[model samples]
Target: MQKKPFTELGLSPELLKAVAKMGFEEASPIQSETIPQLLTGADVVGLSQTGSGKTAAFAIPAIERVDGNLRAPQVLILCPTRELAMQVAEEVAKLAFFKRGVRELPIYGGQSYDRQLRGLRDGAQIIIGTPGRVMDHLERKTLRLDQVGMIILDEADRMLDMGFRDDIETILGQAPAERQTVFFSATMPPAINQLVKKYTKEPVNVRIQAQEMTVPAIDQSYYEVDRRSKLEVLCRLIDLQDIKYGIIFCATKMMVDELSDHLKARGYSSDKLHGDISQSMRERVVAKFRKRGFEFLVATDVAARGLDVDDIEVVFNYDLPQDAEDYVHRIGRTGRAGRSGRAVTFVAGREIWKMQQIIRFTKGKVRRERVPSAEEVEQKRTSEFLENLRETLEKGEYKRQDTVIDQLLDQGYSATDIASALIHLLGGDKPAAQPIVEEQPRREYPNYQSREYPKYESRKSSPRETEARAPREHRESREPREAAARKEFHAPAERREKPSRSPRREPSAASHEEGMVRLVFNVGNAHQIEPGDFVGVIAGVTRLPKEVVGRIEILDRESLVDVSDECADQVLKKLNGIKFKGRRLNVNIAR
Candidate 1:
């Protein structure tokens, strides 16, 4: 059977152009089947797992039907979290980017109401938002649905799980009865089925087969490490594997923030995505990750919802998800678009039962792998170096540096000694050993386990007291404020701060007494500079052997390259005077 194209599915030319620019050559299984029926004005009920390209399945059709000239909202998309709302809005914006006068707005909690109000007044044709914030806007009369032509309930199962049924029903009731409705969910519970029956009118059912729920392309594995040692194990795995992009999923927002910060401190390119961050910051983080500015992203389950990145090479379950279904979603971030990927989970003691449940749900085998030790990392590095050397030898490109190798051999050094020395000079230290951690015993939940539904409570603020407080009350509370103000206003000499470790020090073209001179450059891997580029540019410009390069430390914005201290002046003169990759190399000394 031949597959249909987005243009053939009755999408507008502007939307087709947008999809092509996004590099989507063909539609996913769901999109191919759902878009045609959706364009025919029939309601849709789509059931597919996460990472199944479901967002575009409905969004493309919705944007095509949007009346761009209409200032009022014509389409409403209800998501479960602020992160998902923003993600959906981003996708919609891309589809509508070429459409003139079309605007899409995303509304969610933790965002300034004034900003959302301003957007509403500015005329948004489509509104994608969370249920709580949507209800808030409806109550304030900022979002009117009288002109709404279509409504999409995304992640319907999660909305029910989060107890948003009342809010969803209220919002749906506000829209016109004749509008088209679309319902999408990962699972069809009795409640979800009931809601579908009451809301959708003779919806066209499009379901991906059960076999498609589990992604076979992903190599799923887990390591039974203690909770305390998980971070160490993660760092070791990252160092061992050549990962391009990955996501570390945690159960809570607090854990995501902590893990992101810890990885950043450990010299990893990482960012945090969660519910607590502002909408603008979340967008910026996603943009950075998409642009390859950051290689790793740490996020909670709610924050990662609606994420649709296709190049994630791996998914790390930093903490096991609370619900078994979330295990599917976390791993689904990878192995997308027919590409093979990997998913590694760190399972601690007593959580083995949860792991078992996940394995059972996916009906997939997760092999247990032993953590790599320090000696293993060293062995991997040695193997990589030997491979690179063999490639260079096979290419027959070392004739220019033959004299340098002969001189080193003449200096009472054997081939093994020279290679070992080179390895040692290239930051080839063994990985540090991980600390041992003991798992705590699990305790059973109380009798409330059977009645585990969420409960709601309302708390109102207390009224002010009629009588005035004593002077001590004012004095104690205001003292800290006054002290902070005084500290801010202190004189520069009185408030001397510690000097930064990365002080600016220019490179000197002078000879050194040592065998090699060490020079640092304000460029590193964080600046998208690779090790080979650093060595190649220096060797090509100086007519020196690449093997003579010593330890190179690539920091956030600077790189330190070690050359023979004797030839440091010559190397500096050659490099500092030339340009590499269109940027002048700032050769300097280590601070």
Candidate 2:
């Protein structure tokens, strides 16, 4: 993706300033190609992915063509979902910051109709809405497309797939016949191409070719953890790996702030990057990151655009991106400059299906992995401390403190006891590691929702004191433990797990376990319900934690999931009639 500078795009000085304020230094390929054509009133069929900067491509031209003084709906943009509509509306507002009297309103289902009516009545110059809501407004005559001069359909393929063709056609039919129609889609299916032929007038096709996504040097992997345990798991990973320079990619600015703050409170060196920070502050934060002032720089996808840090050791997708292209872009930040980087994604319940989408899109191998245990982090730290101590002794630095040691030694403290006391005092300043909940027997599952690992907490000790320790024979064998500790992240498909001595067994297929009930859904592989779908859907619909949702078994045409007995009825009540992939869900207790 060769991004074009905005200066070369013929944008007016004011719009350029607005773009600058939006923090984009260059126009993406789609933006550069479509801006000129769109400005000249050419109907465009932009074929690009979600994160290819398509929003600005349509937004800038729409802002340029809107008649601010006239204050009529000169521009109409239709999106497939309320979330996308809101995002597009925000982008338009940002780009139109300098253009006076230009107002953009987002109207979508599940919002207050009275509020939308008020916005429409206020002479909004631009309207962004979903097809269904737009059709509703049109039927009520609350929204008139007669004054619309240009109409854009974003995510056209998605809209058509969501069964919005009739509503979309009706809305377009109501628009002025002479209006310029632009369609941007990730793929040009037959339905979309037919739409282009019938509705567009000799449209200029702007297709961004997919670049060679060569990330062989980066080892990509995913962790199936619960939403509540993400932070703990992230901390454990950072500690175990001792990641010094890394970027933690978040899905939203709020998540960035919360994560950064949480890391700091946990005594981790970290900071945040987002739009809310002043440019000067962002520069300072980036400068500190470059100087290794912090180990982690948490940021959102939009805020990290155009960031050119090459030596990043790792990239953690704190939240899975909605688009597969965005996922690639996020992980691509690392593994640059011929460096072998690590990319880890945290997939919670309901996001399991999304993770698969990314794997299919990238055509790259991704393997499931377990989170580092609390004991593992502690062992790493202790090993590092001893190594540093050895280096200090080799340098003869300990001699400089001999006088203090001599005094303590003379006061009845032996040499080994003195060293242990000093070590204890040094370790006391560090915060105790958080324990991950052990909600179930340890075993590997498709999406190992948090509470997967058993808890391990070290006992506290006084200075120079000792406790009963396990015998060497009974203790964990040092060979396997040391091998596990020394192992590095390998290419997803190339890594092999070290065998454990303990026996492992799969859970019962239909265990109406104590305090839980087995529930079945009329969706499975044929319906495209993969391993994570039942877990994701049940937790998503019921708004319950994934812990209460137990083992899931997906068959050909049906699936069985264990749910807490207390919430079984709630799940049954909430998910009985909901739709999944255009088919109504039918959930019931498994016989």
Candidate 3:
């Protein structure tokens, strides 16, 4: 039997138009089953994974039910993290866009209370926030829930894991008894069931199985690596794969900070997310990541919970999670909405057992990959340099630079030497490896590093001894800035006279061009869409050459293709009408 579209599911015309504009043609499995019941004003408990379109499942129906003229908080959504709260608020705002007098506000810690209060005063009909900040507002009597018609608990499992049940119950008790309650979680433990029984009055139960939770298109794998060599392997893997956007999961706040700093130092556009960072900083980091300003984000489990950014091509587990469930959540960030994604993990020594435990708990398999060798890293670098060099040569923008190369050759420099110099100028140096230190072994864990502390009888020291313990390097004199500058630039005038003629190419058709459209399809290599797939589709459907198809970005959920002004209309018409991978393509010009 053919399934009904969202338009046939009793959605308002404005909502259906908004969904169509957002590029959703049909409802997801969970949405198809849940939205009708919720629209009827019944309590609902939805079990699904991250990126399962749960936000819209509840948000659309809630927005439809909201009485825009009331100008009071009619809907309340509780998320596990501030980031998720903001994301939910954004989605709700989109659904309520065409609906007049409807407004949604996101309230969370690290944001100025005055700003939120001002928004509330101006009349925000829906509120999405974290438990602590919501509780704060409730205590101050700034936020009233006496008339709230609907309440939603998003990621309820995560909230319980974070120990927010008390706050949740307190807030729930403040709402009207007749209000509709909605609980959505990835997993339902006994405690979650208990909460459902306590708050909901015979709610409609919806459970999407765990296997169905993950997108089957995602390709998951792991590598066995030594602890000391993990960073090296990660750099090598990043070099080898053509990753669009990826998230690296760490086990602790300190690890997120350290790993992010190290990746940045190594010239990777990486960001950090952890509990220690301020909420405003967290917002800024996530915004930059979504804007393509950063390609990699190093985050701990707590900071990354409820994050639902799509287009992530890969996920890296820097450190295995203690709880197996977290592993699912970490990788679930990618491979969303029927798109393929890759999940890679690094396991060291005793961590292999933990990996096995995760596999057992999730009923999934992890493919083993060898630690990348230095030779592999060198080969990858060489290949990348050659590709960039070829692009420069073919683009015809370097014609003026030929005179400079001729002059260098006339000065008795070999072509090989000139090429080597150019490579060095373009950041071709290999990264230095860290030194490994050996330590004593422990009994329980044979490979664990053991540190010995001095006995109390032998540890006494005088003030003079303690002072002498400081590193001798710290006592050494430092160089004066003026003297160092003078010494370093002895031939400054001569260097200026014969300046290097390696000017970077300006943005052209090769980089950024006007009147071109960027469209992302929910398919990629995992869906068997290669460069040919992009070229063939555009050239076959529209009157354009395969070469004019600007940068073909292949992500997990979608692939972005740059279409010239001449071919935009025909390309959209053909691609939208055609079906790929047994699903209708959701192609639209990106903002």
Candidate 4:
């Protein structure tokens, strides 16, 4: 069969043009197979792995069917995580780029609900969000699905794994029963199959089997390093390799900003892109990066689809992507248009297992390499400086300086001394050596050539030995069976071990409560810590139920939360030294 182009899919002109601009001339397998079925008003089940273009398959058809004039949600897509929700929303936006009056909103946890409420009030035709956040809006009566023409469960398996089954079912039940349901999952376990049977009516199942991710031209490698040394190692790699231009993929917006700022502070030209950056700012950053105004652009996966630059020589995975397919996407940024590229990933302890999974899924070779040492970095920089000097001398561009050099030489300055002085003047300052922590030495145990077991020996105990081993005084002091049972039932150890605290109470607005002590956390409004987030962290850290946390009071940069006096000390201990959203939480009991 002849290879098909996107035109054959019968997509709208606007969507087709958007696809073309996105550098997609032909429909991917999932898109080609599912879009037509969806357009025909059939409930569809898409079985595809990450990076299989499942987003477009659903997004294109959804955009096509959505009534642009509708001020309410015409489509609702549920994702398992905020990042994935943002990604799906971005793709939907791109596909509808040329379609006027089409609006998409992404709602997820950890973000201010006020922003999401504003978007909802503004009439977004397409709503994409994580299950928890979507449920939150639904509970608050801020989001409605009455007019939703289609419902999509993107990464359905992931949502289920994250314990969103009840939330998803509730949301789906709230939607119009006549609305078309489309589900996409990498695997169809019995739970997912049951969900499909219950929700979808005669769904068309489209399974796009996994294919090997083969980008032979790209050299893939990883280096094992501690979290603290990652920055130092990254800088050394960049300097030692003399990387001209590159994209560094961080996992979160905070990481992107932090890494970008750190790189800039280290005197490297760098910028950042993430969901938090406005579209105009993002466009500006991308434009500058394309023009080589910056040597590095740190970004999260949210910005992955928008990056189309082909001259990127390297893709540094400052943090591994959450999805295995994203690994392919991150590295695929390089080695474009048949040009060789390099992908270097930094793996922390135990993260190697995750990387191994990626290797297996992609069937790609990722060679392990050692991080460049301080001495090696210095040597490489020195060599580069000498080479640059050699090039400058060959170009003969220092004619004006020759007069001063000759005058010094006439005063008995040797040519070597003059060159040394010039080298000292022109060479860039070397970076301070990063402190290295030594690994513990491995101990080797002596190997025995032969195993020696003591010869088996048996002896019979005499009647006198048995009598001597008996506890005569304890036997005489023993009580009758009923008395012994009563005494054991009233054991002091049991009484002491019984919990004295009452059941955990829900956090309230009140500042004080009976039998509870309030604790202060050194992060509040400034850090964007919401009551729910605070409760989540408290529960997560202390293993206490949310109901146990009482009376949360958020101050300018601190928060006071009341907990049972019995567990206040324990809560304080667990909250200490923990970080949330990149800020340390210095938790202590309120005086």
Candidate 5:
């Protein structure tokens, strides 16, 4: 969290004034490290996550590098998505506020071409654009980068992962041979390294404190559960919380079966899914789950990927995921459809490191919560019963039982005794495993960027506070979906959403072809992944000929790509870790 004042980072007085107006006095770690180097005409590969003030790290230097007199795309920035292009352009505008005629324009798909054409004709100096649209402009000669002195790739890894490798290289190839190229990304995978080696000139590598922002709606917390007591913790959470339905993700098929069996035996309506289940059985389980036949579903990540349900109130990470990305995938099942949700993760012994990786990658405040005690669960159950009883009484629905109550009253039982016995009878049998009792105080991370999840016992939202917060929270929930919609429909950033030119190829996944290996991609039509995407991304990243990339078939939740056996390993090695179309493609040879 250490920061250096912007004044010390060598910004011009006017630009510094603009920064002051922005109300950020100090540079975040990334800015502190990369600002001076970039200002001095050195290429930079800033290694940081989103919300780490990465925008300013490149934006400030870009503003400093722009020339007002020769305003013809002096600074070109390529972002992976239209939303990011807009965001970067906004930041650049803020930094260039004090300077005159330092025109900045954002050019991306789905907007009226007239606006972009006018902006280009006006001799805009800084051009921000997504790869596809930028490629379009370049092909039509509507934009030129011959005068560009500096080029920055925002979220470089993301762009390459989204299958923009060909367009990116083509655009970069058109730039002058003498230019500064920079990259900012959350990770440095192989494809990124290839780009760096090919384009940059002795770039300074700055990997500062990882920074990320998370949704305010999800209440993310982890428990220090013993391996033997994980099932107990799971049951305790179900008993103590108002869980409508939930998904519990484990690390293995065997664990899914074991945990599902345990929950069902405890009278919890639950089901399991894993690699071992047949396709028909899986479909049956999914259908029953959708109908609310089961309140809980246990599965491994592999089995859960194809699930198309939403409105899950809770997500239980019964075992810590192997990596940070998987952690995101596991917890993403909840907190959807504009509803607040909870994610409870169980951390055993050595898996704590994996948890740390997740925290660092997500920059999320995963509060360390104490395990619920037996007495606490019992108290929660009793309180819930009383509330339900009160609701039933207030609705006048208890009158139907008045005759039975009268019979009991005539049997010499006082009202208080009858009520207490009835409450006891309504309380079901206790869980098989006793809840873990830990005295560890809850840990909080006020420094990390996360929304506070209010505890049920102490949360107090007045009517006015509730009214005030509703709009803001509603906006918060819509932002990501808005960005996602832009990606899906190829809509422009900060503009009205409307469908137009298809984002990806319009056809489904292609059929199998002879004499080639078919590779399965984790993303499909739902994720805006398409057929031509595989051809371009695979060939461009692997440096293989386009002819080597064969038929591509896009499906609802996945896609298929065909490649010669000779080139399959190369494709997997370089492309596996990259994200395509904003989703991780776990590319593998289809069975």
Candidate 6:
């Protein structure tokens, strides 16, 4: 089972060219298994973690199936968050770059409605949006789904977790029933199953089981500093090191552009690579970088994915990656083909904890390094300059230029003075006198040094003091109370005739014994529902504390959940007809 290229996925030549330009040579495991099925108009369920190339897997097929001449949106992609919606839309747009009349619009919240209206009115063939915003447009009649031929639920589990199940169902129900549905989720809970069962028909399940990534042999280290001083430190390091070709990874597109511009302003050959740049520009920048046209390439994680260059000497983490796995990929850009490379990550004071998590994730392979001081940089530069001069002298190249020195000597310049001036000129300015900003280590607030609040101090009580503190009204005569207790005890022993100990009470689903009931809902493991989903929904709708919701048992086709007797009626009333991860809840007391 060999993997194929995007060209073998039955995509149009236009799309194949776009994919190739995007630097994808071989299909990812998910893409290899899914693209073929999706191209054949089959439903698909892609179970993979984030960054597993699932976006291209579905986007390519959807784009390939699009009828460019149609003005209405033929494909709808639902994401959990606005960020994801925008990212997906970017990918879709990139894949549809060469496809004429294949306009795509990202419909999400926090944007101008008038803008979305204009885009929709102007005719976009593809719509990528969050469930809520998409539902809003649907309700307002601004977005029509009658022509939607394909529906994709990206990060479906996250959408459900965000309580978008009802909205997703409403949107899906409105779409053409003959439409192809594709779902991608990191985990398949029972609720997700119910959604699939109700929506898709015989979907091809492509599960790329999670595997531990093997980190490359790059020397990974980080230095903590304040956010404001990162640029200065970066410049200092760039000035000190002999970086042939390197990448400075940023978290956002703006940061990438800003860092790139800053480096360029400092007279270093650098360029930015990010999603916002056009396809041609991206290709040009990548081409230049591969040819060593620039010393530094500042790029975001998404933009740098398809970057294939082997001679990258260093990778600087200008911003810590939000995803732990991205850290591996960023550093992996270097240290390829038996070449040992260095990955230097710049961490802000607050990001130290995140850096530690990355270290632990990499099994402590990521070490910490002290930030180089101005003196250190100067010393290293001088030593390197002297070494290069000595090497040049050993090569006897100075003999060919001895005449120039002799000419200078004839001009009344002493040989020693000429040699000193050359060394001084070649050594460059003794790194600026500016003091290097010290590393900003993670520091706790002074007040948090002692968490023991004085108000919560414990008090020790003596026996006499405790007895004296008893209320006089409730106190009884000691002698009389003892005599009455003995009489009652003796009478009980005679009457009981060695009565057995009280029966132990078994724990039930409901925390309370009296007026407690177990309820059955029409959802279970067969529906791919998990207890957490039920708990989240019930607690969310009923305003009941999660702790009060009793044990949940998910069976084949139904679930038995316990609720407090007081809120049982309210829970059923609120949850009835309410969908949890796309399935309506038909909750009733157990028989």
Using TM-score as the measure, the top candidate is: 2
lDDT of 6 by residue, 282-380 (tens): 999999888888888998777898688988889999877644577788898998999999899987643565566566566647777776786876677
Overlapping backbone residue pairs in candidate 2 total 2
lDDT sort, best first: 2, 4, 6, 5, 1, 3
Residue 512, candidate 1: Cα error in Å is: 20
User: Native-vs-model 2 lDDT?
Assistant: 0.71
Among the numbered candidates, top lDDT falls to 2
| lDDT, model 3, position 318 | 85
Compared with the true structure, what per-residue lDDT tens digits does model 1 show for residues 324-344? Answer: 456788898998888988999
TM-score of each: 0.49, 0.55, 0.43, 0.48, 0.40, 0.52
Report the alpha-carbon TM-score of model 5 versus the true structure: 0.40
**Worst 10 contiguous positions by lDDT, candidate 5:** 477-486
Ranking by TM-score: 2, 6, 1, 4, 3, 5
Encode model 2's per-residue lDDT on 1-591: one tens digit a residue: 555778998888879977654444456678889998999999999997645668889989999998889867889999876646655775676677778778888886655666678788888889998777787788778998878999999889877877778887888788889989999998989999989998999999999875435345579999987654677788788878888889998765556766685676456789999877889998999888888888899987777878888689999998776456667788989888788888999876435655765676688888899888878888998998999999998888654777898899899999999989889767644344455644232222111112232232254432111101223322111111001101111111111222221234443446557888888888764543444445445544555655677766766567778889899899999989877634688988876
Q: What is the C-alpha lDDT of each candidate?
A: 0.69, 0.71, 0.68, 0.70, 0.69, 0.70
State residue 336's C-alpha deviation in candidate 5, in Å. Answer: 33
Residues 531-577, candidate 5: write the lDDT tens digits: 44565466446656556777766675777788887888998998898
lDDT of the structure predicted as candidate 1: 0.69
Inter-residue clash pairs, candidate 5: 161-579, 162-581, 508-554, 509-553, 509-554, 510-553
Better TM-score candidate (1, 5): 1
